[model samples]
Target: MFFTPFFKMLLHKKYILYLRVFTSLVINRTFIPMTRRFLWLLTCCIVLLSACDKRMVTADNPPETNNPTTGAPPISDKKVQAGVQGIVTDANNDPLAGARVVCGDQNTITDQYGAFRFQEVNMTEAAAVVTVQKAGYFNGIRTFRVTAPGRDQFVQVQLLPKTTAGTFDATAGGVVAASNAQFIFVPNQVLDAANKPYKGQATLSYAFINPESNDFADIMPGDLRAVNDKNELVALQSFGMMALELQGATGEKLHPDGTNSVTFRMVIPATLRKTAPAVIPLWHFNESTGLWEQEGSAEKMGDSYVGTVKHFSFWNCDAQFPMVNFKAVFKDDKNNPLAYTAIQLTRNNNSSSYGYTDEAGEVSGLVPANEQVTISVKDQCGKIIFSKNAGPWSTDANAGTFNVSIDPDARLALSGKVTTCDGAAVTKGLVNIQVNGVHYETAIQNGNYATSILRCATGAATVVLNPIDETADKMSTSTFQLAPGNYTRDLQACDVIQVSTISLLLEGQTTTFTSPADSVLFTSYRSDTSTVSIYSLSAAQKTPGGLIRINIQLSGIQTGPSVSRYFTVAMNDGTYFSESLNITITRTGIAGEYLEGTFSGNVQKIPGNTTAPVSGSFKVRIE
Candidate 1:
């Protein structure tokens, strides 16, 4: 056995060279061994040295800090936390709202603008994987590298619509074909959730992803990174890919039994047919990890590659290539970091990977080593803003900072102030702006908002602004047309009338209450039930000292007028309840709109106590 100190000494280049010379002398019999034990030790050292020399550490393939047996990266002891922001869109570039997005153990749903954000997320590797799922669409995924903790990384995902390829009876399996992809199922092999053979009909939802497509980078799952059978991380050059899902008649997931396999075939794109390899590895995407794992192999036969898979998800026929870490930063002409911009790197084989710059305008990933590549920056509309040919780099490299000029006609700068109908500043809110189908949102701080957007050319653009007030739980929308240039506007949230007043007469004394100070809320739960609440607090009182609240519950109300059956008044004096209350909902608005109504009633101090007159009128917006 080799001692630890001796093994460490042999790791040095000089020591290794000395050992090689000593071994040569021993083999040539020029140096006589003192003992048989010495000869055996030399033999062991020679074997170990030969094994070390097998891993050539050249300029192209630098020494890796990885396990010798498994090519996996060393496990880090430091915990890393990062911030992530992203958007999910469909094939038409339309924002997909309500999509479920998952990153690590944290998950969130996209807002109406198709945007989601995670303030702080734990990251185990240098990269983060985000997955998105929506009804009627295939899963969308993105894997991007991060530089450090507390930095925000952005990614854009586009989901493909799941198209029905064909259907077949599980008992009588058949083939399903879509575009240039095909799936062959075996009879009595399909299993449902319960691990039992499914005898009913099975519907296949499939999508064939062409590497030559313009949106390939946006719609493709992961970053084309995979773990091979040897546990080595490598980049993939795809000839083509196919995503498939099998579902039972009741929309339950179904898959082929492990005992039998399903054959899948994908036709190589015309552009990549010449470079397609005779035999390539087959990789299936692991949605949970957002990484591809090699499972089988496919052999190129004529124009198509055929392989068999035990299950169904996303399968690719890709040629694996060794990679080196690469990084680059982008800036505008004025030397400002271009945050959240789209960047693409295309290999000589036409296979490309895309990523977005972080808040610092930096992007890092693994790229094929010692190969010429073309790097380009694209706008949100998928238009290339800048492109250049770079590298044949050997080892890990930083391409340095790139500066690009933005076309004046494609630049938009907007600044605005948000206010309530009373002209008071909105302290806590968000301003969501949509221009030419792309959404950009900024927080409203101190009632002011500002953002600059870069996009493709549009002669005249229509801009829509949706401002939300969180304090009052109100939202309003406005739209206008403008040309690319810097503009400022002060917006008033008038969609929900802000001025609401209520007058109450009790014991021959009339008290007036106004909103914007007192709280007036209108909530419509369903078509039949609604609620109007008015809460008032005295400035000099603390806690529950001087508080008054009135709750009115209305039933059988629609968009028009209706009467309420329940009303309650809670104050410092006592609690009063009333059964007969008249509430007229003059107008009921839809989403992002307002609700206006008025109420009047008489309440008793208690259910069967002295009566008091209570009448109030309110025209307030629903929160």
Candidate 2:
């Protein structure tokens, strides 16, 4: 009825022709009256238009596009391929690795970066509901649409804590008197077999006598918490074989009535550990017997070990690590104990302790007892002059007396000095060396680094030194091929300007930027005829100070010709609008030589709008 006027307007203009056609199909053209004929045509036109209005379109069944190449008909539905990428983090934005993420049938665990990806997802399937689960955090469930084929859907999932499991406060918990150590556990809320909150109680027990001088300094904060595969929280109280007991009221299990067990994890320091993921039994302290009894073993996860307990008690790790005193004497092939030799002892637990021989060639110290003991002797240059595996620990009371011999010709020594570009000592720098495949990390003492005496290699040995820590961004790699003898090399380390001041003056306004200039990373690529040096520097972003970044690429070294150079600059707003217009390279050098230059450019804020002038200078050593 609403469109009656519209139909009347169309009928008024074209009713005569339509009437003639209808009358012609009947007896004669002039037989029917014009009014009756017009009415009949209107009724038929309204029914035809109403039928067309019934055809509907929706998102699930979209209109199709024709394929032009083969002149094929349009296909309304087609299968699509897609992918999903997401990051799993805690409430604090810290990445959570080992979190399991599931999308339909496909699932993956987050990597160290808290990133996971599901590739080749079939878009034709129902909308995916991604479920993220990790112990100590609430479950994260989100429904996301899969984009078209060859496309990716990126998401960031933050797992919130179900409730606070309270802190492992060493000070308040009375583990140690007035200790500054604290560890907090934000555990995910879980349901027990009775469909109740899995909230249990905890108690810590320890040996009264402290083994170390400072118990608080022995354990780190991050070592106290661990998550199991089922996403359950585990707390640890560790010192030199200290006990941590977790239990529920009465005789209730730590987990649920139906569940097999509750789990806990311990992070062992790499310096004191031999191998990761090794199985160590969990021992319960017997209050009456005054001894520890084995309950079960813990499995390793990377650097930490996860142990499940059927019942809670005063649980401690039974690694059976024995502490013993070693009296070792080193000597050359002849029957004489060598003096002034550095004896290094490594136990199966990977715990290391060392001592130097006295004038009488006797070196006594405490070492871990194991099935096999590794002893190495080295002289000043920091190489292993003598290395061998001694037999197991003796049953006698005095531990053991080791008599070892070293070959005189096997000694090889390497030494170097690490210094800044201005010849200042970088005393806090660290250098990591890789020989064959074994890695040795040494620190710079008084700007000098040295290795102890090393045994001769069977074949050609390759040694590489990588500068790290304070001098990581600065410093060239040093590689050497050696046979034997004492060698000394001086290394000119790269310099990092912790604080750099950059300013932009334009439009009667001065904007200053200060940041820790950690952006300088120098690298080179070489071919038979061409070698190029690339320097990239940028200010740290998203800090209290603003952001500034610059990238420089230079070619043709030592020739002194005007080398082809390109650079880009980014300012506070993260808009890389500053395109290089003119750059001046005043000085250039390689290998401990400094590269000094100035750059000026106009930043195009908008099309045909005002542009800001930017300029800066830098002086950094070439790698």
Candidate 3:
């Protein structure tokens, strides 16, 4: 048997190409397109095909003398070969076994080493999907194209770990009912799905309602945070949530039921006089019933006392009841030492007759019954720049201290220029001589300018200063980083920024201004306030196996009263998010103090106040 020259070229290359060869039958001559050296491969195909059909082909070299009755032989005489190898792992890098590997109907299971092999298989025609499965872990599926024959069988496929369902119950004496404290919850709600239980860090929020309208009027000064299972720190609202220190493991969970422990900050109620009349309600999350219910009223818990003790209030009262002396401490977010700036204590939104802060930032006032109060902090402009309201509080039998925090209107302090030299600020742009890593950016404004960077992380920032008018000219640049404390810098007044001549050092190095005269005094800062997200428990995603439920407590510091409300959260690109949730804030009671509380109500079928809950979810993105 023999082969023609045309069939040899197509078989050697990686592709299964066909060649058209011409032949003259009458003259008994075939004109092949290729040379004899290339026909060597077709020569072999003819030899093999001759065993099946002798007349199909003829080759340049004659077959063994014993068998020679053949024309040109056929193609496709043998099989193509390749090897398949890969590794299997879990999402956390744990080795996986029993994974099924298959190619062309040939299959094998992964050994203890998570390695598999499928030998002697044809791979030229198609691809296959290798699937790994375990009873408690999420299944892993990967596709591989059987492109060529090989001996290596080591590819890697990682399966996501499965999460076990857990529960959160308030009955263990750990989950507390909201007293008078307003909640200022932490913003992170991401449950680590890689572990058995989903764990997250959140802030607690408490609020107070107006007796007449039941709307938000005040809140606490600081909120407590539980990070891991141990270290705890009180955080200031609108402060950088970035450096928030935690007290505990903040163990994870996929749902409410999966949580084993949680942390919150509660408040002690103000002291009540013998003649005062008021009712305080305490609220807690009912994990079993999927609702929020009162732990017990202040009266029912025996927390109320009608006897007269030295009042914390500094002033003398008209009634025979003792005047208790009380003090209020003020601190900024980040839990740092700060001067309690002057503030106005507004009564029912009317500022004409309210009390003002004393020398120590304390407001001395008297309340006959339970009260929800507001302390509005003033800025240099003499305007009420930041004001927070507490949820609700009823005076009890004792007096100690009440905290009033002034939350700034905008937690952001910006001093950077509006634009850079390039089209916009890019990675490592330069202003003057510094390079800053920017974390926050506003939406693209007009074609000329951009919004200031808001809630940016801790870092230096540099913006390019391209001239807007000339487009080709470069303007002088500015760069700076904002520290945690109050920043006071003079603003630089300038026209359009030119990009033609500015170069900022972006290598993340340091610069020493040998002479102060050469340094530019640009007043810019980047202190951003972080958000603590509060989410609705109604539609939170359940554990995949339907085993755990999640219950969250909103906790935080407040003024005399808290701003009670609901909140929502969603990922940057997640299609589904949260709806409005209901929050109930009550005054705090002294720790280890038990009260025989009573149920006194202005209980209506509908709570009178419904305001949008404070945005509590913290977000970290580089802008």
Candidate 4:
């Protein structure tokens, strides 16, 4: 141990330079005399210095870590893949085909059944936002939690039609009322599309959504989930909601300036009036994010909740509640997944939320925490297929799989083949079925259609089938009374007509309209005369000061198909009218059922002497 202190010094990383100098002196025989013990000690010191260097290097650069079981990177660091599927419908619960749906970076269009799916979407957040857009309706949005990876969630969005409530001049703002909702606009507060002050006549379109309505679950924008002022996701109990929009005289979009606020008064439903909070948070729908964000607060005055907003879109008076993630899977008695089925969750306070099952029969969303809720699965006909009480979960949890036993006597399966008038298979079509006042629709594939319906009624069930042939543009109607069981039948698109469609071509543009979005009337007079009136008002013309209006009036003596009659076209509140022209009238084989025809002529603007050539076709149901 002659060089014990020197060995210790060499082991210290900070003394490496001194160790190098000592080793160099020893090698040159200047620091110490040569000896076997000294050489051995030098060897030991070198070994210890190497070991200390290795320890410092290891501390700076550690080995890569792996999962103990998988021997790969941890799963928590990887991106998760989840899927979403759903349906889009109108306020009447009718499917909206060709609607555009978007979620995150994925986008798709709805099929004939209003169904859409996005598979294997990359998700990194706890929730996902979905938005739906279709012409002639307001935008539909939903935000739900993505509870698990590799799982598909379903959402149903119902779009409300855009309707004008009232109008006022932008220079002298006034009040407008729609149903139980009232709006107050301040003078010189309206801004046009360019964000400049607008001085023209303004049209106000509004809709007051009553949360107690049967269609509230479908018609509401979101699942009552919102982000509070603290940026925390929470559930909401809505008192009422109002959707508003303002447009200038020439159809330019308008909104209130940031410096000025618009006053809103929403009447709470009688059922919820007693429980309505005196002051509640006001949230506005964010179209880009498809989520509601807290903006301000509203106060209750009598039966109405009044609030002021800086701009316009959708405003709601809602009370917030703590929430936790909920998930479950549903299966039939045979262990088959109950895919694309409706599921509803009703809170103890009567407030409700809804979701649909995906292809795997799985549904997930945020629910109120520590509260009792009743979950019900319903068939297309609105019959409850299964019901159960689910608990007050204090944390995120899955309720596991639920097996539903459907009564065989309550199930109705219908399968059939559809053909065109010439006995050719109708490749593209729709099978619309109506039972017990509820409508169900399915797409036709290669002339074959099949669907299962669940009915709770006993005895014979009355069913109405309306098959449409897209290939030949034809349709047929049939009714049957049968017991609840599987049945096979064939349908032909022949004489029975049940459609109201019209198309007008003026100049180089074609404007096509379809009912029940448009109004087409067929009135028969007692004097052996009949008249067909077709009226279509665009979204702009639904308000005052709108300049464009399309109307067609047909009148003639009693005549059948292929007979040409006199008709006139009017525009802009009869400011312009077409000179008398020839139009053919045809009965659709069934008396008092429908009228079909075509027309071509010139429309002249009164006092201006401007005439435009117009041609169009129509197929209208008799009223």
Best by lDDT: 1
Which ten-residue region of model 2 has the weakest summed lDDT? 173-182
lDDT winner, 1 or 4: 1
Residue-level error in angstroms, candidate 4, position 452: 7.8
lDDT measured at residue 102 in model 3 versus the true structure, 0 to 100: 52
Per-candidate TM vs. native?
0.61, 0.28, 0.20, 0.55
Better of 1 and 3 by TM-score: 1
Candidate 4 least-lDDT 10 residues: 533-542
> Which candidate's TM-score is highest?
1
lDDT of each: 0.69, 0.45, 0.27, 0.66
What would the per-residue lDDT of candidate 1 be over residues 1-623, giving only the tens digit for each residue?
Answer: 65776678677764454455444433334222355435433444544344334432233433333212244432233447787877788888777776777886456556555667665566655557888988899989887677667777888898999899888777755556566665666556677776677889999999888888888888889888888888777889888888888899999998766545666656788888788998998888877556787887887765667677767788888889988889999987756567778889988766788788887678888778999999999876678889999998899989999998877665676788899878899998887676643445677889988766665554567788888777876668778787787779777665543555455565565555556555444432221111332211111111344335555665543555656656665555655445566666666644345455566656677645887776665554433
| Candidates 1 and 4, the one with greater TM-score | 1
Quick one: ranking by TM-score, best first? 1, 4, 2, 3
Candidate 2 lDDT, 1-623, residue by residue in tens: 99778657546533444334433442232433465445433443443234223322223323233111232111112445555665566745556666777764345556454666654344332234466777644455443323234444444565654342232221111111112111111121222334344444432222211222222211111112222222222322233233332223442423212122333434454343444336765655433222244455665444444454433334555344444334555555433344435566655544444444443345554445445778877643335666788747543123334545444345445567888777777768776554432334456788888653334544345666765437445655577776555568677666443334334444445544443424343333322222332333332232334444444455543333343355454555645544544556677664445665655667565434567776665555543
Q: What shift in Å separates residue 583 of candidate 2 from its native position after superposition?
A: 1.8
Query: What lDDT tens digits, residue by residue, belong to model 4 across residues 386-496?
Result: 999998899987999998887767676778899988888889988776553234566788998876665545567667788888767677778888778778878887654
- Cα deviation at 126, candidate 2, in Å, is 34
lDDT of 3 by residue, 106-151 (tens): 4444544454543234443122334455554433433222323432
lDDT of 1: 0.69
